[model samples]
Target chain A: MIEIVNLHKSFGKNQVLRGATLKVEKGESMVVIGGSGSGKSVLIKHIIGFLKPDEGSVMIDSVDIANLSENERYETRKRFGMLFQMAALFDSMKVWENVAFALIRHGKLKDKEAKEIAVEKLRAVGLVGVEDLMPSELSGGMKKRVGLARAIAHSPEILLYDEPTTGLDPIMADAINDLIIEMKKRLSVTSVAITHDMHSAYKIADRIAMLYEGRIVQTGTPDEIRNTDNAIVRQFITGSAVGPIKIEGVTA
Target chain B: MIRLIELIGRFVEILWSTLMSFARELGKILLLLCATMKQLILPPFELKNTFKQIIEVGIKSLPVVVITAVFTGMVLALQSYTGFKRFNAEVLVGTVVALSITRELGPVLTGLIVAGRAGAAMAAELGTMRVTEQIDALETLATNPVKYLIVPRFIAGVIMLPSLTIVADFVGIIGGYFVGVTVLGANSSVYWKRTWDYLEITDIYNGLIKACFFGASIAIISCYKGFYTEGGAEGVGKATTGAVVLSSMTILISDYFLSAWLFK
Candidate 1:
């Protein structure tokens, strides 16, 4: 459903992505694993039509989204939903309003119907009776759940999750992983999730791609990744400090 | 001698770079203004959000504007009375006060005050939204952040600044009346007559027009700073400060040119 080719991005003197490329099939869960600041977020941002690549194209269903006009890109984005690393809920809005935002604005649904759908989506994410509460009133895990609810509220054809399991306890993270699995099964949507959490990546990804130094170093199933011979992939999956991957801001 | 020449070259280079950066920032702000104008004519006018911002930028600013206008008028009256007493033209205090308040103080003071208050608030709010990724989330949901966020503020600022200036003008005239006739012991009927005699409708409308420009500047500058904010909490602080500073400078600087054109 999505294909990125030879993508290159730079922020001033910092070259974050250089010749990175990847592809994902429809209705498949593609998890991108990378260390912090590995341009994982940048890659997905390209797919979602947020950032334009300097060198290459991001093709979604054969259309180069990088070249679309602002209005056209906005139309293309209707098929997408994203959960930010911080949940990024509208602090000014109620939980239900955040979830029902697209429904009211884009879907053109009335308040009553939008609220009903919001409530149903919240329930699907295992959240009940917290619709009227503000985002500031929720815990970290609850905020993530609420974000998930908001993401899936419009039943988007594709979903993107940025560090969905980070900052949560192991149990809470596991629960989020399970929710990701469940949502993929229920909605049958294409998803691209970026995370450093190997456990969550293994649990939720149908195929895992390891992003290293602005390129996809390896792509394989969980079992294959666990048993890979590539030193970088093996070192990353094993969580070893001593590895070929140089830790940023650290002297070897 | 060689060192002095090198120092001069370095200073010129620094000055040129500063000017270039200022020009770039101005270009960005103008682009934002154009984008906002484009969105303004587009469909999906957010009336609810606009009304909310009107209250935020207009009605809520009433007390401070009124207070400033009243004090400014009173000060103008007292100062004019003292100055005119030398030539025994004390009776003209009302005329001076009325003209100054209607044509200059009313809109300028209100603009400065709103730029400090509403402009800063708008920047802080939008900056926080940008850093927190709520803005990105909005884009992902197929919602135009500029339309949903900035257009309402632009409408509110444009609508409310003039409205607030009107209130300021009225209150300021009343203040001058009290100080000139009651406190300073000028003839009540003559003071009232002189206040209206020299104050033309053109003066008030010109001031209102200036207020419109100030309002647009405040909204556009604040939104631009906020919408592009980076670096998190510290970035928010900087954006808020930059909004107020830039808005205030724009108002004051533009006031001179606007006065030159409008009055001439």
Candidate 2:
């Protein structure tokens, strides 16, 4: 299980996350939902040790990861994988190389072995024949698939997604949602996804949490989130501007 | 007088702020440098990627570097022949051409060429990655940015600059010889012999050393500018320009100090 306990993070005077607490059980998919600038990404960064929390701790597999040294972070990260918003594919590397980057970097496999594994992972993501193509050559959905392939290539126990479905069309988003579900079912991995896309949350989440004003306002099952009377959750989930979320900076 | 005083005060303030920021950023760079050195020494040094980067920065930059050097060489010989003829010192033109290029022009022109091509490219590429959150993605993946990105380029720059300078210096000398014999109506033997006599290992070494420092300065400044780029497209563009300009100015300034020490 992964746990975030009393996590606080601030950038200067602007507090991003204040005492934000959450947990996802082993073999669980927990989707975090929030409006724009609601600190979801900051929370993910803190969990990944890319940003240290000002106070409190993020415990992964019952270890306090926030206090780990850089080497320790590397070791800890061996158990984790992530799909970034832009897909973050290393443009310099070909598709197979991108998929097998960790394998090559850590010296866990030889070139031939890594290539085989990369091909297998690409196949798992439904991208078998495109191994020689560059990230720029892939379409948006294909890039995300390749990103997913690379993320899970190492068989991480934990998978994190930052706005995984943001740039995809509706059908592609649904396809990705299906892929996420299929991966979770097969690997029994703990998945934590941060996004404003409620359709994705509804599709992949076992439990949904709404982050607002730097704190998690509501945490419950998907049905519970849908039926909740909280105005913020309603405004966010229903795509309505009638309630608390202001429209001056955001389009929807 | 009032306006001048006000302007001077503001300038000092800006200087102070810049120095303060430089000190802070320099400290961070030193720490990052230590981390990079550590990773480089350790097993699994990512040799494949480093070689790729070398090919990208050093080998790929050749055409521009050569073109610029040849032109500068031609121009230098043309200008100097006019001045040397007044003193009837036209035969010594080869000596002067070889010396000036070795001591200053080779390193300076190569640095400028790289500042435009490699340096700007590094800044923009890294800056775009910075804005696009790819660097952060690397961090999340437990890839050290300095070790993976900056240090390889830094090492490559230090290694390649002198080699590039050698090429530039060689091409430049030949350019001078061509101009002197063909265009300036000078004896080829006199030009080549003077050049050989006037030039030595020390002059070549001095320029190579200058190039080492020049390459380091450009890589460091460009990497720093790009690594911390914020905002969007405009911010990335500004950072690339800032890197090239800053790298050029620092090379010129550092050149003076290097010359004083070398000559002394």
Task: Identify the leading candidate in terms of DockQ.
Answer: 1
Candidate 2 Cα misplacement greater than 4 A, ranges: A247-252, B1-19, B22-31
True contacts kept of 1: 0.97
Q: What is the TM-score of each candidate against the true structure?
A: 0.99, 0.93
The stretch of ten residues in a row with the least summed lDDT in candidate 2 chain B is B28-37
Quote model 2's TM-score for chain B: 0.91
How is the predicted docking of candidate 2 categorized under the CAPRI scheme? Answer: medium
TM-score of chain A of each: 0.99, 0.96
lDDT of 1 at A150: 91
lDDT of 1: 0.94
Query: Considering every candidate listed, which one attains the maximal TM-score?
Result: 1
Cα-based lDDT at residue A96, candidate 2: 92
Off by over 4 Å in 1: none
